[model samples]
Target: MSQLNRVAWIVTVGSCLVAALILVLSGYTGYAGVTLAVAIAAAINLF
Candidate 1:
């Protein structure tokens, strides 16, 4: 695999995890936690 493919895989897996975390948090805390996790993950991947 190439560097871009590797990064894409990371992004895809990260997105799935973020979504699941958000969904789980949605049932308890709310959208805020999910949104925060997604934002944090996105920020991490950006750099």
Candidate 2:
């Protein structure tokens, strides 16, 4: 269960970062910032 939780958070962080990257590439800085914030939060939860 712990391992699964870790995996879920990792995937959440990874996907959020990827989405932020795509958003930045498309010039959506505001949305990208939000996604990046979410990624950071997920990373914090990870540890």
Candidate 3:
């Protein structure tokens, strides 16, 4: 299940980035920033 775990992490990072983008478009900079941080953390897990 290693492959599945990697895929899950990738999806998590991708979705977080997308959510951050949406938040930014809707004027939720604070929340967007938090989302970005989470995305960064997820990306780190990719390594």
Candidate 4:
């Protein structure tokens, strides 16, 4: 992949990780955390 694509993927993954961490730390668990993380990452990418 191109450098720009790689950077985008990195940002997406980083956003997902941060989202998941926030959810977990805020008392969300398991599927809820993963779903919220994916949703947050998808929203970020969409924008």
Candidate 5:
């Protein structure tokens, strides 16, 4: 993979981890939003 792709994956994983942590602390209410946001971010990096 290219350097940019590597960086993007790192950011995506980091954000997902952060989101998971937030969901854990805040409960399921945040789960859907965080998951959706992470999915969109990851999807964008695919192109």
Candidate 6:
């Protein structure tokens, strides 16, 4: 894969992992909003 593609993949995975961690730590509340935002960001990067 190209460098840009690798970077995008990393960002998407990292963001999702962080969001999941945040959600888990917060008892599945509060930062639920971040999950959506991160998913949108990842989807945008796909193009």
Tens-digit per-residue lDDT, 1-47, candidate 1: 57886688577657756776767766855665665566566556545
Please report, in order, the local distance difference test score of every candidate based on alpha carbons: 0.65, 0.96, 0.96, 0.69, 0.72, 0.73
Deviation in Å, model 6, residue 24 alpha carbon: 0.3
Q: After superposition, how far is residue 6 of candidate 3 from its true place, in Å?
A: 0.6
Q: How do the residues 1-47 of candidate 3 rate in per-residue lDDT, one tens digit apiece?
A: 49999999999999999999999999999999999999999888888
- Angstrom error of the Cα, residue 42, model 6: value is 9.3
- List model 6 lDDT by residue over 1-47, tens digit each: 58889687778867786887778787885566667567767766656
Regarding lDDT, does 1 or 3 come out ahead?
Answer: 3
C-alpha TM-scores of all predictions = 0.54, 0.94, 0.94, 0.64, 0.58, 0.57
lDDT of 3 at 32: 100
lDDT of 3: 0.96
lDDT of 4: 0.69
lDDT value for candidate 1?
Answer: 0.65
Candidate 6 wrongly placed segments (more than 4 Å): 29-47
Q: What are the per-residue Cα lDDT tens digits for candidate 5 across 1-47?
A: 69889788778867776777777777775685767577677767756
Q: Of the candidates numbered 3 and 4, which has the greater lDDT value?
A: 3
Predicted candidate 4 versus true structure: per-residue lDDT over 1-47, tens digit per residue: 57777677667777777777777787788855776667666556543
- lDDT string, candidate 2, 15-46, tens digits: 99999999999999999999999999989988
Ranking by lDDT: 2, 3, 6, 5, 4, 1
